[model samples]
Target: MSVAAVLEKDYFTDYSILLDPYEYFDAMRAIGPVCEMPATGALLVTGFKEAVEVLRNNVDFSSINSTVGAGVPLPFEPNGSDISEQLEQHRDFYVGGDLVVTFDDGRHRALRSIANKLFTPSRLKQNQEYIHQLAKTMVQQAVMQGGCDLVNDIATPFVTLVIADLLGVPAEDREKFREVIDNAPPPGNLDQSDAPTENSPLVFMGTYFFQYLMDRKSSPKADVLTELAQATYPDGSEADLLDMVKLATFMFGAGQDTSAKLLSNAMKYIVDIPGLQAQLRADPKLIGNFLEEVLRLEGSTKATTRVARKDTQIGERKVSAGTRVLVALAAANRDPMRWPKPNTFILNRPKIAEHVAFGRGVHTCVGAPLARTEVRIILEHFLAATREIGLCESNHGSANARKFNYEASFIIRGLSELFITLAAN
Candidate 1:
């Protein structure tokens, strides 16, 4: 067994070093830039240069046909085949938008044109007030309540509601929608026997949305769905409705959970680091630095997968066509070769943004700007409003056997719940 295989079957890697992940990554970096994980038959890239290579070299390794559950440790099943199919079904929907984060060539270019309008400098500036108001509401709701779980109470709603609003869902249905989606089973959980009819929230949502698209067809409002439904290709043809459902579910699923994890981790790290939090509370200017550093030190979503289009070299190992590469963003973010004094979190770390938390190249993360903005808005409100919040329970549900007791899951990396109590300034 290779070193990686041993590490996976047995968490021989000093994982406490991973409570601060940089250490583990640094060790991996020393073993050449990339190493193969025998356990999953996947290549693990830990160096900044090679990892970036995997992302930037689009022709050699394609992101479009990448499988989500290809190779990773997970507690639950991940239906790699079905999820991959659903993801690809929405390709034409982005015909007029810049789905820059996940597409290539013609599709990516089309999205770049259409999505540009939504993220224009003026649009972002205009939404500043709207963003602040939502952040204010989140803080206010938890204000007199004394202590609050940042993950469950504040972060989830603030970001989810904002994305929903941007997507054209009725604000009234936001809470109910968030509840349904947040707990939706992982794509792996889908079973052909079940047919999404368990009267579960996921079922309700799947049914409601398929029907919802039709209901919005007549005199459609100017929401994202309507725009998506109404959007035309270069040939002036309407996008298919099936594509719309795929995009809608992607918007909600990808937007809510990922952004919330970032917000939650960012806030928790800020509160946990007294000196840094105090600096932000006073200067406010440091918030940007704080954000970058958090992304660097504690990434939002941990890892993403890509498949090799053809034979290629990953670090010292030669990878053949169809090899699965697991880009450990969290580990790569802390790679020693990439950053100076890698493990420590200095709020003003000059090279902080190098972290691959948001990803890179064709499939980097479409929601990155929005995710950063949400974190910025919420943190700005919290820093200005509250003086202190602490983790009431540093609870660990399962003993982290791996280098970080990382959820034995393959795809998304996040807290099940980060329980905390907030005290007002």
Candidate 2:
């Protein structure tokens, strides 16, 4: 299909975008790294080098929600048929001056400080056993079925439960959270705002957890949930219930889906390439190397957007203070300049950690270490158990490289579903 044709269907809607990502992405990359979007009048930064440059330049660009307006464009289609109403509601967090993503300097540092307590090495260590168990147990469930869709069968359950546990979602609500992903109307035909806002089952989950947060303010529990409950404002004030709700929602919202797809995509390719799978199974030692390779090639969160803090040069283009720049992490991870034969997936790519799948700047993903650890462990146990994993005859095709479903949402990249039939030894 021609570029114009793909842009309308895939780029305009969430569901369609996931249907065949590589084709669309390759076409966009061919247009040059920093091309302007005809519809939104914002830069669609698609090349690997430009994306890294934009992300590394924290002084000139920022993640604050304030930048999300017309000045900064979302990666996918605009669904806010009623833009004014969307802005009004968005104003709540936007007015906070800066949240984790959109703020800069002192403000960004302050927000990150409150966020960091949860990520303390000790707190993370406390969760190691839980991560290991969750990975094994979830993997077993998929194995039980003989054949499985790794993304939905194993990945979603594992990541979603982990987030749910962290947020103190009652075990009862766990299924409900998964249901949102299972049933949320993907943005194909649905108008975007109509895309379920955070207020559905998620709203209740956030509110229920916020109360627990309030209860632990004075008497802090050792858990991260309690720490988040008590996270303070940039000033000396403590976070309120609404603040807790945002934090609560952002916890799962920021990651679960993408984490699921990261595993699925890696699993999909590794299993198909029996040689690579065999190599990993024999030397489980290379699980870290394999995960890094997967990350560089098939990143979870494809792109992140930031608005220019002031009229400035991003490599060359003069962006106005409010101009939004979309940094394509998926594209950058494969930039030929940064990696050898950028398009091919080499399991032993050197210094693989350099890939910015977790991003950079003050807003760099706080969950990077934990996420890496989880993906690593998941692959280790998985590769160790299986002899050779591959696509069932039914699922075989070159479709993966040419077409793949990533989360169509403007915010993240992940597969909607990954189907694979595994042969366990």
Candidate 3:
């Protein structure tokens, strides 16, 4: 397709693209590895090798200035390509705004250090038993009900509670926060609105965590909040109070929704594939690979935006300085050159681990370990707790209810609602 033709197609606002995107991805990739949409001043990258080149080379493509405020470019771009200056400029636009994903300065490394300390491999492994028990409890509740909306009753609530535990929220406040978390809309849900503000979900999180962090600072306790409050940079400087608040708030909003979507996507396939649950129950070892296949097939994030710091080339396409680049991770994950039968979901695919579902390079999802552990435990517990899982005809209002609605956003991809019936084992 021509540049003008691609520009005419609104990748960000079109709702239909959310429901089905592989065709669009294939078409864009067919044009070239990198196709510049003149209207948006962005290049859509759908090739695997091209994406890795951009993601790993942060100097050429600066994520810092790409999404300065509310994800769009600021009025005045930072003068030079200094990572610190870019971050400082971003912070000026949005106060209390030093997100680990967007910030590319000393503070970014410091926040990342804190995250590594908090969610280590051993730490996540230790939490597995607790997560399994929690999943089992939720599954038992759903099994008793005969049928339930898997997205709401199981995946959504499970992720919220897990995040609450991870954040070290007091037991008293968790129940109240569960309601707040469940009702909050996930990313892409607000894309339809014009200049969508933080809305209810963000406002609730920002207000609640602000006070929570203050309490943690004044009265230290044995929890994640206390740890965050006392975290320091490599230079031994204490983390700023506002930065901590922003990190905490961002974690809840960004972390919960993605984990829930991962779970929901995996379940949709398991219930659709005949005897898959039974096979999984017989051999629990396959659970890990199964989860990998699901992630590869349906990653929660479809595309993330970046901008060229200086003129660069992705494949043969020449990208100019300050040009926005949309890295389509989902499309890259399905690159035919990288994987044979790229569209199929094969649990035992040898190269499954190579997929970029959690993204690549510096901006990879920090909550990845937690997300994996959460989904693995849920699947393990669900298989052990249920004899059979099937779609609920009454809930869908038809016997042939294969079609489903998805989140209406170009960025995040997930089912809006998933109703299922389960028989107890």
Candidate 4:
């Protein structure tokens, strides 16, 4: 009946919940589709239909509080049925408010246009060979060592370089970008404070991208950066230089982090499940559907935040102005109403693409296609090069008593380290 009785722990700050969230998601869903958390006054949308309703209705719900969720208090008190004006006035005060993810309406559309250029079908087609070659080379090196921490040795570097190449970041500077990102704390890492300090990677990345875009404007070049610098809004007007820089850096940071986590998450299943590796290896075509199932069961992002622009109803629950809504994508993906036996992983599940792993509506992830390509290519390579794939007993113990550490974050869900043994074919 009470939040404490159901959840038993703080969903945001508690470490145990971060390690295993599916049980808690079940608890939340048991209450109601759209249940309100009395502690934070944030409604948690755990049902599939309810989550989709909230995601699609951008008119009544603004993404201003997306990054912070209900973790922080609103700058001003809600007085009426619409706090849209207040959100705008104090927008700069919210975390990640200026980033493209939080932008709404026209501004969001215009900025997304410029970001989309880098991920065009033709652009990804051109990068396909590079992705495959890079995956092959990286997986080969890991196989040479017999075993490697898949998170760091393979997934992290593999996705990082893939994004670097796609974005036209210079080859000479790739390692520097990798080092800067690796050294920086993950967005919501719990051991360290989650708050962004002066040393945030965005500041560093923004500076580098700013200089690059500025140079491209002055001296045009045959690169994605040059095209992005010259790209205009839907109305054919030029975009702000600072906005462009923010978009580029955000893409760079988000692109690698989520995709790397996804790769590690998929590996956990590949090794844990009996004969799954051999099945995929023998029939490479099943790899795409297998990845879709992984996304459904263990998506990198657990939940995204939205704030009510005005009074609205999410399902039967009435959310007032300024109310914070936590759209639980991971929970929605497993909702029994949507997927029968949602907890069990079934290969080749019907309509697998309907999962909200990358989210939905106008605010759906712009990098979804790129993330899929990176993971699929690397997975194919790992299967091709190895006779057998398994977990390192030293790191994860044996199958019955397996112990693993997940990154401490309320937002991202991923293994901290996935050491795996590879038997080369």
- Collision count for each candidate, in order: 9, 6, 0, 0
User: What overall lDDT, based on C-alpha atoms, would model 3 receive against the true structure?
Assistant: 0.75
Query: Candidate 4: global Cα-lDDT?
Result: 0.86
Best prediction by lDDT: 4
Residue pairs whose backbone atoms clash in candidate 1: 74-408, 74-409, 78-188, 79-188, 97-111, 98-111, 98-112, 147-422, 400-405
Candidate 2 lDDT over 1-425, as tens digits, reads 56676445424344555554555666676766677666556677767667777877877665654223323343333232223233223445442222355556675576677776666677667777888888887666666666677777788778787767655566886787678656653322224522212334445456666666777776676666676766777687876556556666666655575567678878877866648888887788887877788888877766677666556766567676656666767777876667788878887888888888888656778777667667778887677656656665554555454334555555455666667665667
Q: Lowest summed-lDDT stretch of 10 residues in model 2?
A: 187-196
The count of residue-pair clashes in candidate 3 stands at 0
Structural similarity to truth (TM-score) of each candidate: 0.79, 0.82, 0.90, 0.96
Model 4 poorest 10 in a row by lDDT: 190-199
Scored by Cα lDDT, where does model 1 land?
0.62
Q: Cα lDDT for residue 267, model 2?
A: 81
> Which of the two, 1 or 3, has more lDDT?
3
The alpha-carbon lDDT assigned to residue 157 of candidate 4 equals 86
**lDDT against the true structure, each candidate:** 0.62, 0.64, 0.75, 0.86
For residue 422, give model 4's deviation from the true position in Å.
Answer: 0.2
RMSD for all candidates, in order, please.
6.6, 5.2, 3.0, 1.8
How does model 4 score by TM-score? 0.96
Candidate 2: list runs displaced more than 4 Å.
1-10, 14-17, 65-99, 185-202, 218-220, 233-241, 395-406
| Candidate 3 lDDT tens digits, 294-403 | 88889888877676767677887877666678888899988898878989878799978888888888778889889988998888888888899888765555545577
**Model 4 residue 299 lDDT?**
95
